[model samples]
Target: MANKLIKQMGLPKSIANIFTARNIITAKDALSHTEFELMELLDVDKEEVTSAMAHVSEVVCPPCQTALLLLEQRVRNETLAGHLPTHLKGLDEALCGGIPFGVLTELVGPAGIGKTQFCLKLSLLASLPASCGGLDGRVIYIDIESKFRSKRLIEIGINSFPEIFLKKGMAQEMAGRILVLRPTSLSEFAESLYQIKVSLLQQQVKLLIIDSMAALVLGEHECGTSRQQALGVHVSFIKSLAEFSRIPVILTNQVRSQFGDESRMYSFQEPLYNKR
Candidate 1:
């Protein structure tokens, strides 16, 4: 099957022979090895390995659909599909329903502005039964700043949804659905995200909350450019994860007063991505 697909790709005969020699006779076999491994196995250069891998990925993966079809699907399933409401009436209205799925929704503010609190609320809400306007699925809360308090989450849950959370073991069950991960460094954070991507479906994740991306990026000891580049890569991976999982991702960020203007505050980490 892999040989047929590779031949259909019009790749050179040498590359085809390498696959045959290596016993890479299936798309899964071809994709199971990384590019570096494939290069070593096939004794081919990076370009040939890359081209072959790309062809295998395209052939094995799901077919790509048009944007119009995607839009139509979303429209047809809007009520059941995309958004996850915070269940905060005013905020929900202000947000045009709720935080949308398949994108990064940032909550930026000063230190005491309830960013983590809001995240906690969303976490509990996401774990509730779907009949109660929740996603009825698990949550992945990456607590970068160590701000996640299970006690506070319980307090909010009980206070907001007393009927649902007051039952014995109900709160425990809700808390069990939320997996909190704390990664002390940027590399560890990236690794955690990668692990989450691999376990997303199995874990039944409906929401992903990174409490303050700024903390991880700012804590990095690298110079500004390097930090920015690393941050960009991590951000792209996170966006990809959200889109691929079709889940709502909430990221918190801290704000600082503009250098020359105390009256105006902006995301402290914004400069890393947007330099004037």
Candidate 2:
């Protein structure tokens, strides 16, 4: 757009074309271009480059600013400011409040670490009212290892909502809240990815739990590198769901230890993002 503005003001076509081709479509780029650099590209002297810049400056417009006012009451809502607590005070405080919304949380550890149990508890808690440390929304648990305990959820519902259980149709209603899905294989898991997104809005889900992400990745019959690529794909899909729906997505996984480590070889809690 900056280049087009300069072109409309009578800059030569060849010169304007070079702006985009050289990745200098912005006025800032034009301003930063060295006299020697412009000489090479424009076949002009330093004086001509300076003259061209003055013309470019006139076309370079600053972005306009806008402001908004939000209601005081809406600022403190559960979906935005507040987090979905696990209902365990110690655990919740340790996590600096609770499991937050609108992002993916990956939990990695070996077996018998209660990853599945913790997820089950969170799913049950997520169905509770906001005053009870929940988002008051539905849960979708994608089970890859067939460890989804429906009985556990029912027991929790009974204890958590005993009064609700006393009423007719409430037990069945509570049972329907936490939807369990067991994808038999990684390929099958991939097929259900799209439908899960649709279910989030339709069912009004705000918390998603995937029990053991490793099962789907490691179960694939392919090279180790291929498994890594598959993991990337799975991460991308879940990330899209979290960001688009503005909900918390928790995924558990297992890690392997390398044998040939002489001294702290397999250690890493690296930053999630880095330059390639």
Candidate 3:
């Protein structure tokens, strides 16, 4: 079956030279040229091809998947190796020696658990000078909950990367570059992210923050849909944005409460212990 597909695509048997033995027959080469050229070679609808790849790649040893995985890991490692230092001396060590780039890092917990404070401190640290422990990259704060406080940010910035705001003129300029977006609706929130992506591509921003995922989706709960569907859309949209922009997206999610009696706990425990 794989041989027939390869023959139909006009690919050569020498594909093995480019792919590993496990994946040589199970994948189509990604187009290296224009979209029209890709369409001509694949001879399939773009959406169909995307869906087919998503399904088949899960079950087969896909050449493209293997190659892409390696490429992503290589980029991640290189970025981590070259990452700038942070002011909080022990923070980097806590994170396995350095901040990672091109990958998402999730810091989750209940409210008032220092999630926002941690993000604020990290943003400031990200903007500091190399000598003073900073990455010198612009930060974009997406305040979906309207919780951003410029004064607080400045205070944290002063402590974490004081040199960045030492001069009035430089401070104002740096503040202007530290973009902030507080959207009132989901559409607006999503649009702001798209704008952020465009800005990043144009060298206007670097780091991104989406504080408290629950706040963004809580408004949608009034629509009365199933909880799973609501969460699915929210997660899917965020994932899509991350993949398309190839930027790190830090999204904080809320945990649901569990309520039951001691007997209920015992019932759950019994099932787990009985499994063995």
Clashing pairs in 2: 102-247
Ranking by lDDT: 1, 2, 3
Model 3 vs truth, CA RMSD = 11.9
Residues 61-134, candidate 2: write the lDDT tens digits.
55454332232222233236456677678966755467766667777666778888888778877776666555
- TM-scores vs. true structure, each candidate: 0.66, 0.69, 0.61
Decreasing TM-score order of the candidates: 2, 1, 3
Q: Model 1, 1-276: lDDT tens per residue? A: 444445555557888777878787667678779999988999989998898888777766677889778766654544355688888788767555677777677777778988899999999989998998898999999998898999999999989999999999999999999999999988789889889997788989999999877678877744657766776788778878877998988877776554476643323223221111
lDDT for each residue of candidate 3 in 1-276, tens digit (9 for 90 to 100): 333343234334443222333233434443223445534455646664455444434434444557567756655563554543344468655444444454444555666777787777666666554465565667888788777787887777666555557766656655655677788877777677667767776763556777855566667564434544655665566556555555555665544443543221101011121110
Model 2 C-alpha lDDT versus the unseen true structure: 0.69
- When summed lDDT is taken over every stretch of 10 residues in candidate 3, the lowest stretch is 264-273
Q: Report the poorest 10 consecutive residues by lDDT, candidate 2.
A: 267-276
Error of model 1, residue 116, in angstroms: 0.2
Q: Can you tell me which runs of candidate 3 are displaced by over 4 Å?
A: 1-86, 129-132, 222-227, 243-246, 256-276
For all candidates in order, the CA lDDT equals 0.79, 0.69, 0.55
